[model samples]
Target: MAALPTVQAPGIVNLSYAFTNEGNLLYREDSLNYQKEVFAYDELNRLTGWDIYDDSSIPNEEHSIV
Candidate 1:
């Protein structure tokens, strides 16, 4: 995988990643580091929404299908 440009919005940091061979974006991670909210996408390249994780990487809350 390759790291792409990182776009910073109002309250979120958008990180894009692409495949090494196909150059297709495998997924993206959107996060508010302050809030510990992270959103993960799938191969379809859509926003599968977020899961709240603490510093320990434990899932606290999740939002999907949005």
Candidate 2:
């Protein structure tokens, strides 16, 4: 099985990520640090969008897609 990728949310709430813009992350956030949203991926396991949520088990503003 493939190992899980690391997720991160390193910034203040309602504020943009210190490193990059949020739009590039493919989801609008009410709070980048606190908002509950999940990463949406394609069948090939590539990120295609986001599942905006009021609650989620995930947190992160950006992803390092390689």
Candidate 3:
């Protein structure tokens, strides 16, 4: 019998999520790509804005929802 080579599986995703006490998504991050997403809500728990950060880039992208 011959030994075979071992290979790592592809398409593996390393994601993390966070939520508020009210069960609203607050943050999400991808550890593999060093990307992060932050969410903001208003007093009524409505989405107001969000920001996405890429560690590979100099400027972070931010978006405001109306």
Candidate 4:
């Protein structure tokens, strides 16, 4: 799990990550705030859904890929 830079609001530190070999982003965290998100993908490398976790590390919301 490597951290990738995020281009969100200016001066806002955000961190995204992906699998080393698959290059699939599995999770993202806001370095300047409390936002933890997870991304899911199908076998074909297509996005399936996404899960949002609160600061407590509990899933709070989810949305399917369109």
Considering every candidate listed, which one attains the maximal TM-score? 3
Number of clashes in every candidate structure? Answer: 0, 0, 0, 0
Query: How should the candidates be ordered by TM-score, best one leading?
Result: 3, 4, 1, 2
| C-alpha positional error of residue 20 in candidate 2 after TM-score superposition, expressed in Å | 25
TM-score of each: 0.38, 0.28, 0.75, 0.68
lDDT pick, better of 2 and 3: 3
Residues 1-66 of candidate 2: C-alpha lDDT, one tens digit per residue: 232233445563353322112223334445644464445555565667655454465444444344
Q: Model 1 over residues 6-45: C-alpha lDDT tens digits? A: 6676765654333434454433445555335555566766
Candidate 4's error at 44, in angstroms?
0.5
Once fitted onto the true fold, the runs of candidate 2 whose alpha carbons sit more than 4 angstroms away are: 1-34, 54-66
Model 3 misplaced regions, further than 4 Å: 1-11, 56-59
What is each predicted model's overall lDDT from 0 to 1? 0.55, 0.44, 0.75, 0.75
Model 4 local distance difference test score: 0.75
| Residue-wise C-alpha lDDT for candidate 3, range 1-66, written one tens digit per residue | 222222233457677777787767788877777788889999999999988988754439988999
